[model samples]
Target: MGKNQSSKIFSPELSCTARIFTLTPHFTQADHAIAGLAINHPQLVATSSARELGRHSDVSEASVIRFVQKLEYESLKDFRDALKKELVNSQTAGNSSVSTQPNTPTEALAQVVALCSQALQMLTTAIDIEELGRAADALEKSTCIHFFAAGGSIRVAQHAAFKLLRLGYPAYAQSEPFSQIAQASIVQSGSVAFGISFTGSTKSVVDALAAAKENGAIVICLTNFAGTQVTELSDIRLITPAPGGILAANSAQTRVAQFAILDALLTLITPRCEYVEK
Candidate 1:
């Protein structure tokens, strides 16, 4: 066990897969194999004996025990118990339960599909129909729409903007903070400022939304967490189910949820919005 390793590495906010990825950089070369095995086959890690895991990962029995200890677990049994709990939590949290570890490509796809389905299922309830309707109403009346996002979320922002463009709305997506701030100054009462931040703490999106709000633009936000800076600025907030992450912003499942929200908006606005010159 590494003495320098902190128990704080395991945060409740992070999923089991997130914990493994975050700690992988700090692990020894042999521990890397254990990390992969644990992520793909958590049940095996929970049920297998130390000798069995060692044989499976091509490490010694002592190394297997050391790996568990390094994760701040007191004993192999404690680690196994924690793993069991995580597996159950994942299944309950709409993260899906696939008893068979994904060895084949098809099996791996089943897990992926299951998680995506879970995310979508969570969104059906997470979204407030009234809020969605208000957002659609705002978009229908807007002369223009501005999308604010940063990092990976920028792509999602761009996607939404392009969809609006085809629907005859003058829409633009800005990832660069300064450009967004500058652009926000030009937006007015008939404009829509749509912010995308899964974690809802993105300073770029928050700042843009704030600026647009001050300028009398209808502020809208798409986020996973509620009561965040971006959401606070929004007149219409679209919240989605959070797929836990250490990074916290955009997880794959959360992206699926966000996309579904955007798709729903497009559906609603299509009938309400009148075509304008694009």
Candidate 2:
């Protein structure tokens, strides 16, 4: 069998979502079912024996082993242990959204606030300040900044552009795909192209950033996962924690994390822009 193309080496502190996201739609039906239950309902998998999980997911026991192996886990025991640990950490950190449950409004509010806080706290470790410095350095030299994103991430891109504009960089965001690609096409060495994709797999944003990179613009990506197309195209990668469990990728909590990531980057870029080398 070929090696798993997705990032399978778990970062103990990182949410397992990133690897799973990149391994997607290509997954076998058995694999998909297993992954879904594991994420949104870990109690169904983390504690089950391989055969029990097989019955639970309506697949064969061998299929159960194959699913975990596809994620490149060392063994069923290792996979379950890692999943259990992730669930515990998430619960202890107050990141308590499982995507499979209903909550009262009060409980929901608390859950969201806690999730956002957890995301921010994870950011301190998930992000590499030195790599972030590289992004700031790119912004300092680029004559203009172009932001690219699609769907829910469009708002995030717009927010970033506005922030940079306030900081006095000639920043632009094209909501339309055509305009984005066209703008990227004309960018040259003195430009910066910023991409925002929570899953790090949005095709339009990836295309725009690829064009930007091809044309010599510095490409920087804000994403929740590594080793995705968006990150592959980026010269600088800014990672934030993936908010919530599976199937909640577009939840408002994700935007909170994303917005925080941009604010952090802006904070670093802000001071540099003020000096204005005349």
Query: Which candidate achieves the best TM-score against the true structure?
Result: 2
lDDT of 2 by residue, 112-207 (tens): 677677666656655666777888888877898999998888888888887777678888999999999898999888899999987788888999
**lDDT agreement of model 2 with the native:** 0.75
Local distance difference test scores for all models: 0.75, 0.75
What is candidate 1's lDDT per residue for 38-106, written digit by digit as tens? 755787888999999998999998888888876767688978887888778776543534344667897
Q: Worst ten-residue run, lDDT, model 1?
A: 7-16
Can you give the TM-score per candidate against the true fold?
0.63, 0.68
Backbone clash numbers for all candidates listed: 0, 0
Superposed model 1: Cα runs more than 4 Å off: 1-101, 245-248, 271-278
